[model samples]
Target: MKKYNCIWVLLCCLACVGTTSCSDKKSSADEQEKGVTTVLPDTKNEVTTQILKKRTFAHELVSNGKVNARSKADLRFETGEVIARIYVKNGDRVHKGQKLAELDKFRLEQKLSQAEDALLKA
Candidate 1:
């Protein structure tokens, strides 16, 4: 019984080795016939080339919403001053140095007077 078991184990090992060698040989022969060479890919320094061909892609953007500006800005005053008046409304075209809103100067004038009195005392 031990002799039969050893024979079966040897046959299984031989069968696996034989199949692996035969497959390797056949694959190498097939690659040679197709002029294919095995090359290790350099994933770190891989260079890819692409042809710049013009492709027309038609995409219909169907919606009830309007396409607004690509960029939007929320303008505000740097100081925490009260806004007395606003010259421009929403979606208004404004230029640089344009007055957008007026600051409430009554409180600002009182603060300035206090600061000046402190400076005079010092």
Candidate 2:
């Protein structure tokens, strides 16, 4: 039984090696053929040719009015409580609806207990 397991493992290993070798050989042959046809553009005279003539490099420096979000928010908490987390810092870009910050959940737990107690009393 041990001999049979050894044979099976060896055969599996050989099969994997055979497949990888065959694929490597095939890809290498393809790449060799592709390399022969891959022509690199001549860059030797490009810079010299451009410098032999006068050229005007014009760039637009436009002072445009504000292009901004349709609406903006200065997010603030209505009640002052210790913040548990701040996921974003100033100058960090965020997608809409991303969790930017979180209030201390321990603070909310007290409010939850109070509400539950009031419900039980009623």
CA RMSD of all predictions: 18.6, 25.8
TM-score of each: 0.43, 0.39
**Alpha-carbon shift of residue 55 in model 2 (angstroms):** 21
Model 1 reaches what TM-score against the true structure?
Answer: 0.43
For candidate 2, write residues 3-46 as lDDT tens digits: 99999999999999999777746776888887686678777654
For model 1, give the 10-residue run with minimal summed lDDT: 20-29
After TM-score superposition, the amount by which residue 47's alpha carbon in candidate 1 deviates from its true location, in angstroms, is 74
lDDT, each prediction? 0.87, 0.84
**Overall local distance difference test of candidate 1:** 0.87
Among all windows of ten consecutive residues in candidate 2, which has the lowest summed lDDT? 44-53
